[model samples]
Target: MTLLAVQVLMWIVVGAAATGFASWLAHRSYRRFLRKSRGPVSKSLGRGDVPTKLDTLIDPLEAQFPCQSGLATLLDNADAFAARALSAAQAGRSLDLMYYIWRTDVTGWLLLDALVAAADRGVRVRLLLDDVNVQGFDPAFLALTQHPQIEVRLFNPTRNRGHVVRRTFEMLLGLARFNRRMHGKLWIADGRLAIIGGRNIADTYFATLDADTRNSVDADMLLVGPKVDAVAALFDSYWNLGLSMPILALWPGFKLNRTAFRHRLARHVGSAPSRHYLARTLDSRTPEAVLAGRLHWTDKVQLLADPPDKAYGNHSAAWMSTAIADILTNAQSEVRLITPYFVPGQAGISGLTALAARGVKISLLTNALAATDMLLVYGAYRRYRGALLAAGGSIHEFSPLPKNGRKRDMLHSKVFVIDGRQAIVGSLNFDLRSAFTNTELGLLFEHPTLVADITGMIDALSAPDQAYTVSRPDHALQWTVARPGLPKLMYVEPEASKLQRAISWLVGLLPIQAYL
Candidate 1:
């Protein structure tokens, strides 16, 4: 071999050896961490006795709302914050929360403070969060769990707890196991009142303070009565699953001093921003009305949630997608959908075409390239737009500069309104990830009032200036861009950067379509 060739071969061998050693070290560290932290422990939430005060509080609201059996109230934007915080504060027995993302932002700490108060009042609080979003916030959660009545668990936890190098290594090495996330979001109190929908517990989801704090436009449902019980049962199932690891179990050395911990949390909550939230939440009338004998409730609602082991397989039996499919198939007249990430792979395209063929008027509203948070997802979604439009589907993409002229916000709400009779709302998105990877939950109901309310919201959102309608004029792709007042301007699919378009094109060539 030549001298230069020998040197190049030597470098390749060295690089391979380094890579192999790194992988071996990662595997070894993960195994040791798991071995040290392994344990079997306590029972799940919702098994405790119902509180007397809980019954007393519900009686008056029950009489006022008069929901015969099942009911839900739409909690939009800031009101969602009230629904969640108030539910926790007013709980007399149990408080259970499960979310995919629980950030340590202003909104997050405020809710944490409320849970602390609930725990102080002897309301048993159980918090279950997906581990992906809680990487650096473990110490805060661990401190909160110091309260004797509170327990925090992480679903599908990373084996490398606090070590950054090991964490990244395991995540890269164990992609399949780590990729399937728990996307369901729920907040239930006293097994009587609940809030379930797309809103994660963060300032961005609430957007009460200012436009800068608003990351996306979203919605949640504040539900009371029989529906809450079903939600609690779902929480229990996941809480007891083998995949959930308690906070203390994950880091046993983190000692819990209840008094000191509460004090520190109190100080954190007393910060200026937190105080503002506290004042806003306390003064909010929506929460007062919700807790105090108000809110019209209907009795025609059904809860649908994916099993905790959904990533194992996808079929007609266990996934929320099955339920959603059934709803769409049953729609005879019209179907309207709103999702941030709209990658409806082959099955979705085929199903929608079939529905359109059956004379079902379908309207799809999603985030435009400029309005989407995930460029890769947007690219995946863009590839199917032509096919869907050809199938007689009307597509509207939200504009970055919406009619209400705030900071650019992404579309995060996931809603399915079918036949103007059923409204399905929750954390399930239209992309392949939500369909086949993450666990999802939603409420499907046949209440005319609720359906009309949600449908009206969709109508307003798809109106002239709020979104850009994608049309195929003369069998060519065109965007009817709506400015404030002038006639709609035509462009060749505006609102996306050239770089973004290129990235989308490249993404479409990848073999990860099923996992987008």
Candidate 2:
């Protein structure tokens, strides 16, 4: 045979073999995943015991003052957002801040200053953070942990001896053990009030930028109400869990005088002041408060909450699945979800399709390609656009705001509003990562005002300047961002560049969905 013919035949054989192997691998993965889901896999968690020292903290925020209960205040941007946060910390008799990431940038330093000031005033303070995201940023926060009244705990920390061994351990264990992130971001003040939302202690979230907002898209909520108790309980669970450590022990040269601040906790009753804030927020005096308002659609508002004890069971991830089911079951008129990541896999796409079959209007708003921080997630998400679009589920992409406008606000809200009347805001996402990997929190409000607010926000976001409408044609996808030359951010099915598509395909083939 001629050499050219032989070479061509060899190439063909190799190509055919590789294609078959890939197909087999995909099938195997599908089978394995289904099996894992069906198996009785017990979750990893330790029981939560009540802290005997709870009485040492005063939380007037929980008092049944002249305010509505569950007075949830949704924050707009980080400038005013930070002010409220810092002031709350300063005013609190006792403060506890838990986070996944608290970088030592402009935002971090400012918050640290506020916490230190609070500590100086004899306020008892505690900070819990995940060590993985800290990288080299520990010293800045660790220094504060040394203060007498302050303590910091690292979550599932890595003993990175700065070697290849660290990489090996991470590879073998798959980091799934540590994939369980403290996605919870809350600030408990005086044990009575707390703020929960998508914002982390970072500059970008604060939105204080130059004329052009860069690295600046984010969202979060400042919560004040009885629900604070449930949130505080979750915090204490993590604090006392093995995954946490007292900040005092993690630092040196610490000097804290918690004596005077400890007394600030109103001992008039067995409950702590922080405890009072939660109760008050839930049962605030305002007749129009979130808790007091009559739900427009009471029966459909199913609250799938992930409390502290949930970590020991299926946790918040399980609750989120139930929430997803709720979205499917109740999305009669229309459904909208705004999540930072939009990596819905086969099951998610199938669920959306089922809803569409029933004539439900479905719309999704997520980061466009250039706007997304997690390209891999966008990649995986790219794979299913065609299927979803065909099923009647529409998609919209929130690009980073124009360079001349306010900083590109990252729509970090984990919100799901159904038929314009029921809504949920929590740490949960539409991806498997949120469903199985991270710790999350959220509340389902059945009030018309709350629902209207969300519906309006989604509607405004779906408009031109904010979000680009995503459409599918001939099973092909299209994106229309306001700025023409910025490169396409959203794709119909999975039409990102070749590199992105390949990256997503590879990740989709792996078991990384649990980690995002």
Which runs in model 2 stand beyond 4 Å of their true positions?
A: 1-68, 83-90, 161-174, 210-216, 247-318, 405-409, 481-512
Q: What is the TM-score of each candidate against the true structure?
A: 0.88, 0.71
lDDT at 186, model 2: 72
Please, what are the lDDT tens digits per residue for candidate 1 over residues 1-516? 999999999999999898778767865765566556543554334534555455666666777656544454554666678777777777777888899999888888888988988888888888999999998899889988777788898887886678999788778776666788999999888877777889888888887555466467776777777677778778888887667778778786778676776677778788888888668766755445655444446777889899886744445476898788877988899999999888888888889989999999989999887777788887788678888899899999987564355667778999999888888999999988888889999888778767777888788778866788998867787778767553466654466678987898789777677677
Clashes, model 2: 37
lDDT per residue for candidate 2 within 80-145, as digits (tens), equals 354344434445356777787887654455466567778887776777787667756655555566
**Candidate 1 Cα outliers beyond 4 Å, as residue runs:** 1-54, 61-67, 256-264, 286-288, 292-294, 311-316, 400-406, 484-487
Give the worst 10-residue stretch by lDDT in candidate 2.
39-48
User: Which of the numbered candidates is closest to the native, going by highest TM-score?
Assistant: 1
